[model samples]
Target: MTSPLFGQMMDVPLLASSLLSHAARHFGDTEIVSRRIEGDIHRYTWRDCEKRAKQLSQALIGLGVQPGERIGTLAWNGYRHLECYFGVTGMGAVCHTINPRLFPDQVAFIVNHADDEYVAFDMTFATLVDIIAPQCPNVKGWIALGDETCISTHLADMATPALSYETLIGRCDGDYPWPVLDERSASFLCYTSGTTGNPKGALYTHRSTVLHAFAASLPDAMGCSARDAILPVVPMFHVNAWGIPHAAPLVGAKLVLPGNCLDGKALYELMEAEGVTFSAGVPTVWLGLLNYMKQAGVRFNTLKRTVIGGSACPPAMLRSFEDEYGVEVIHAWGMTEMSPLGTLAKLTWRQQQLTPDEQRHLREKQGHVMFGVDMKVVGDDGQELPWDGTSFGDLHVRGPWVIDRYFRKDDSPLIDGWFPTGDVATIDADGFMHITDRSKDVIKSGGEWISSIDLENVMMSHPQVAEAACIACSHPKWTERPLVVVVLRPGATVTREELLAFYDGKVAKWWKPDDVVFADELPHTATGKLQKLRLRELYREHVLPTVDEKVV
Candidate 1:
């Protein structure tokens, strides 16, 4: 009898510091571009990023920030904020990214809940810091991401101890090495955009953050690499900007950050200036870009692929990108609970062999899950459903990067060891997932369910329609009927009956929205998801004419 010995390897921790160090050593010359809020472009290198990040780490340590303490950042996507990401996490403190788009109350609530010891912000959020400072008693100090003049001019007379980020880093030579940290230690914190009640925090560990970055960098996911120039239109406060801040540096991708200016013209000019090859954002942002380009008869000089998530991407938007701009739209789906990367709509070779229309249909679905993640659907009885492409159910997933529980909460959100995604979806035999609607947003008419997302997508496909949302309207006979609220593009016009007629042979007759209402704009959440609850409240008493009246 013989015994076998296992192979041994070095036991190095996968800390966030490793990503920055790898970039600094391997791709130091790569340029990191940023469109600053002060109406100018900021440029630096990864080598400089590492040195400044280390200096910021020294600054934090000098400010009495202890390991495991929460350090909050209220800034846009820029070099300084990026430095904070590595500096705080590398020094073993939790980097809490606060969403400035959130209400002042929610901002204060999140900071107090995380018990942040220090806060770093951009000039754009100087007013916000002043407003929330009185509410957050635990925040002891504030660091504005700028020089002395900028800080004094932009962020003046703060209640707490205040200073400029440049001044803080200037005092140190940046030679302080990063501390050795446990892989399982908390590294970052991001609060969900409270759809139900108060927002809940998702505390991420170094192990989870690194693993998520690795998974997202794969070719099947975000396809990040060193040669690509990435523009993250998505906010850093939103699920770590869908984990791009980590994935980009892990591969040394050039970063083009749009700071506080996301309008189509601003984004297009920045992308043109930086030669952004890849970008990520919600559908609304892409819509703005598409409209701006279409109006100007301009083409993307180098932008190639875009990852659309936070909400579903309409098929019209996909076609516009591919047909007009030659940009491949990667339809993605995720939530705050999943470290915000679950599935990306990448077509398989076999599916790509199909006709263009057929392939477009497949691309409309949220593609398969990336490696390290698994998903299944559950029926109303809490039983798992089949992957027949027709059996729609509640989508549930579990993965290495997924959250098991909310920060500081006692209850576990997992059911049978899987996190319920609150999305009603169907996983086909080929493994493509089509999300029909949110569990709460589905329209129930005469005991049959209808997908509001499907209706909205159909409506947005109209050339004149800029945005659309379908919600269940109160009805007398049918109990509930789908009503479409739409926003027409400027200089375009369409009648309600004309719009209704446009849906004639597309979807099921019953699934068609019974009525249409046009507005100047549709309300959206901070993350750019359609604010259906607010729409429902706005039109709670809306009633559809009887079917007999329609027959007349």
Candidate 2:
């Protein structure tokens, strides 16, 4: 007989309401801070926010926004957006967050697709709303999340009445009991970027979200606590800032909100001013900060550790922070399915004895799977590969919080009970998983897989390159070719030939980019992954020399 799930017998439903409110009841005085417009900072306590969120929930209900209604927010990370994280969901409704970074059409499509009844937006996104509101017919209303003094210069055409977020909250009655919520009911709907296809929604259950917060708080995961002041530089719309909003108050940690300004000088200023001890964001955000620090001659005095995800953290980026700046970048890997946290790259006790250089090398891998996560690499014949770190195969994973299926999509991706993460990986003798390449992003040039990530990481190590992205283009002989697009650092100069020369001795010449394209900036997805498919389309016509290129 199979063993029962440990908490299966428990009757109490773990809801986000319970998580946010419980902390407010006990840890009421804890601070949640945000840097607002014109560099002004605003602050609110957990108790204050919980009380307001409850009031807002009541106000929303009074607006005939019934239970199970879909409410959306188009604001950056702030006290108001954090309030709605609880307010909408706590009222027995679904909180839908739209990534402002998505194309206007995409933003409109998701809002209409989700049938969001209402939208609350920031003033800074007035132009974004003007473009999106008319396209989303189901969205009956738009409320601007700003003070009365802020002008809606770009929002004249929409019929929806734009009310200030403050006005709505001010109308709320501060005392309201959050209804007892069903654990399986949809609390939030997060859409996966349509890089592979159309963005689909993931309906997070009350139980899954609360439990995931607990799992994320563990030492091996984010290791978050009350002692830390956290700045979730990650967008709040993305998996609820990768679950930081819920996790931060779990221990009543002081929360710092960055409010959409992710530039290095701004983030460094916020971290220093807020005394932020920990933060999490995509690798690009940190990479910008690293470059900005080099030019500005600034330092991150308060930040001790960071969680790098959304893309692989280049070894150079990791070493620059850990070795030079005294900050640790814990590489975490996951997709929208696993509540998106499948792995955290932390060195084991034995590995600590390795020299710093060796540690940086090991840290480049995705690290071992976390406690609740079970992973195995399978060959073409369906046999599990040994953990020798050399043999590569398709990576298959299974876990509770991981998505078995995308909401409202039919042609099933799940084979049996296991979900194929669409990643190619290798398991080593030490039990660490080194991701060889993304299954889709993997280049099959002459029947051999070339990792675009590995190639990009190597090129990023070049001092003149600010960022690099590798994409596969069409090839006549090999059937596919790798072309690298590089973003040169400002004031630094390098030619395509120089970059190819840099790779001559390091990797097989054939593995080098068939041709390097220079871009002032690389195209990025809404979630920050390089939009390689676009690059592939942009450069498919130019063919690289095959026979003359050094294959050895």
Candidate 3:
């Protein structure tokens, strides 16, 4: 018998260009504010952005950029960078965002690996471009992300054949048409930071990007809307700035790009100037802003909600933002492999109906997965663990936007079609996933496992502690024990006994840190995550207090 079915539906492909077209047609007048690297505020509208992006498309075509050709951008979050995002993708070329924070050699490696034919960069990276350009011979030319005067007057002595971005676009007639490209075609490329090894590029499709934008714009995700002015302190090179560059336009929200200046004072000033209502960035950036505000006796004038990711957000940071600053902190977790947005900490209705303290506890966890993501924890036997909130295992996730394989690689990183997220986590009965530790960061004690994240969270909650990172230190009896390296608040002092006493009733006695060492500052990765590998190297030979015969 023939299956019963409804009438035929339209099969329009979801493309990234459609987003820009929608914004241009409906929200053309929406603002796109940027703090330029030249120490000035540059303002424009979505209409202007659309026009210039089209002009950029024409310029690239004039430069012999073919469809699917890789175009590299080593710039910060700004109007010009946004134009590159649309211009490159709209014309069916892949937009490869190279992280300038990566080592010069690493940057050259990524550029050469991607086989990028063209590069565009901010003036701040002119010297960096000069160093890496010689190594990246495949790069056809460099386009400075500024006007002719800014390039000549500022970067006059640069040896690269750098063209002015404005000049390149000005020569175009702004009449380029976006091609009818396949939805599954590659649109963007972002390389992993290579913390463990060499960086691997993750090529994303236009369809996946559009779907990610839709998921991020929903209320359960970023909750972006036209009424909100969004500031992305995260740079464009990192997972497309957590996909905010697309989400903002999808929802018609005002875009505020914080160019080269990510310092707390600069961020605060730009946020206030733009009347930013929402923002997304790492925990370290927010900590700096909070500290500056506390010292200056100032508060967020218009900023309301912030999504803290790139690493686990401390409970103290969350509480401070909600209690003292009247702003909400949403703890998000993701990786470059997942298009950088896997989970967000939005409370469910049942959880929200609970007491404020109960809700806060729920929020402290990573919360639940968004609409487009499927998550599960699996044991070593490759069996799925129960969501009882106790069985911690390797976290694996699969989604339309998730990366299945690295670019230029034949082997796949998927197991049973799900990408292993490299996170050890627990899923509660309500579907809330708590990241206990990274797969490599989890401390394996004598025979049991200890959660470094739990210990670090407790230590950070202490009033005197500013930042904390727990690493497994070698122990004679126990296979491994946690040694917490901490950075105390300015002018704050605390003894090791007092700090250990603070954790007395908080965690298990065996889970207690073996030692507490203080430092003036802690090392961090380019994306603001604590560099635990460096910490491990620094404290590899650190011996516990030695006693006569007991070795205590």
Candidate 3, residue 57: Cα displacement in angstroms equals 0.7
**Which pairs, if any, clash in model 2?**
387-428, 387-429, 388-428, 388-429, 389-427, 389-428
> How many residue pairs clash (N, CA or C atoms closer than 3 angstroms) in each of the candidate models, in the order given?
0, 6, 0
Give me the runs in candidate 3 sitting further than 4 Å from their true place.
Answer: 1-7, 546-552
What's the ranking of the predictions by lDDT, best on top? 3, 1, 2
User: What lDDT score belongs to each candidate, Candidate 1 first?
Assistant: 0.90, 0.84, 0.91
TM-score of each: 0.97, 0.94, 0.97
Per-residue alpha-carbon lDDT of candidate 2 for residues 1-552, written as tens digits (9 for 90 to 100):
999778657577778899888879888888888877535788889999999899889878877898888999888999889889999999899999889888888888888888898898877787788878778877767878766655344345545568767777788778898788888888888888877656888778888788788888889789999899999999998878988999998878999999878899889988999899999989888888888888888888889999999988888898899878999888988877877788888888999999988887888988877777788888878788888887888998887677767777776677667788888999888878888888888999889888888899899999898899988877767877788889998888788899988887777766877778888788888888888778777776766765355444
Per-candidate alpha-carbon RMSD to the true structure: 1.9, 2.6, 1.6
lDDT of 3 by residue, 243-292 (tens): 99999889898999999898889999989988999999998898889899
Which candidate model has the greater TM-score, 2 or 3?
Answer: 3
**Stretches of candidate 2 above 4 Å error?**
1-10, 37-39, 151-160, 381-383, 508-510, 547-550
Q: With candidate 2 superimposed using the best TM-score fit, by how many Å does residue 475's alpha carbon deviate from the native? A: 3.1
Clashing pairs in 1: none
